[model samples]
Target: MADRATMERIWEAHTAGEFVAQDVEATMDDDPIVVHVPTAMGGSGYDGVKDFYARWFIGRNPDDFTVRSISRTVGDDSLVDEMIVSFTHDIEVPWVLPGLAPTGQQVRIPVIAVVDFRGPRVRSERIYWDQTAVLARRRSC
Candidate 1:
């Protein structure tokens, strides 16, 4: 089971736009590692995860986003979290939808994540969220 402290740190770090490679690594398995993401933003693995951010956040100003609240359910080696993520698309980012111009919009979306941990690391994760809302907002701008 992942401790609350660790989870808190994860939330804080994510919100700070500081992508801790170790944190990402702690949430995956050894074989065919995968991170199942919600709609709008599909899933990926280790390098893929990093790549996703590179294309998504890194493409823009990392300061535009923040990760919050990582509520977790502990079950032996599994840790499930419903995290609250808040961000503003004030800067130009890569892969972001066109016409979905950045209105400097700030949004808070709840995402559910299920992760299997190997010791202090994560083995695999599946994240779910409301993609339509995200798209609607992006499009509205």
Candidate 2:
């Protein structure tokens, strides 16, 4: 059973700076799925997730990127999180910015994530953020 601490540990592992694909895999179920809703950048299943993490998400964050949790709701086998993700766009972040080049501008986006677990490991995650807000911020910057 996944408790609040278990879910927090999973979240920490996912966002940790020096983690490899296998490190992430250890925190997930056999057939996990992840979706970054605005960009459709995440992957499904084992191989696909490994590839996505290795190529896009893991170690892809900019030097100043950070995630600040606004609120978190935990259940027996699920967790819901509200956060503000901020970064200076100084490098390619395909998972967040997709095909856009680095704008060298500061950006902050509010994000919400729904995570489901199975047998103390994550089964899936659906992450949401305001795309229009990001575009407007980038346009003004």
Candidate 3:
């Protein structure tokens, strides 16, 4: 089981978009860490995870990106967070919507992330969201 403080720190960093490579290296086990996002946009292992973050996450420049937690649960070796993520689509995000150009719209979507921990380190993170809601919001804007 991982400590609550450590989990809080990790979540805080992620919400703030401050979770960098060093944070991943320090919080994840030496073994491969699996990351799964919406629309089959993620990968397994440290290198694969790093690449996804670099290309899909860190590389983008969304205006006013923020995550607001709706609920959180902690288990023996896992944590689940339900959140509302909001951002303005002022720049292209290929990972979120491949080949789709920016629509200059704002979107707010509910998201859930299930994180499994190996002792004090993270083992995997599976994130879920509705793609249709995102697309609908974009079109409505």
- Top model number, TM-score: 2
Tens-digit lDDT track of model 2 for 12-36: 7765532334358767778989889
What candidate 3 gets wrong by more than 4 Å, as runs, is: 14-23
lDDT of each: 0.55, 0.82, 0.70
Clashing residue pairs in candidate 1 are: 15-67, 26-122, 27-122, 28-122, 28-123, 29-123
TM-score of each: 0.63, 0.89, 0.83
Best by lDDT: 2
Clashing pairs in 3: none
- For model 3, state the Cα shift of residue 45 in Å: 0.9
* Model 1 worst lDDT window (10 residues): 18-27
| Model 2 misplaced stretches (Cα beyond 4 Å) | 17-22
Q: What does candidate 3's lDDT look like per residue over 100-130, in tens digits? A: 6888777678888898877777778788888
Q: Is 1 or 3 the stronger prediction by lDDT?
A: 3
Better of 1 and 2 by TM-score: 2
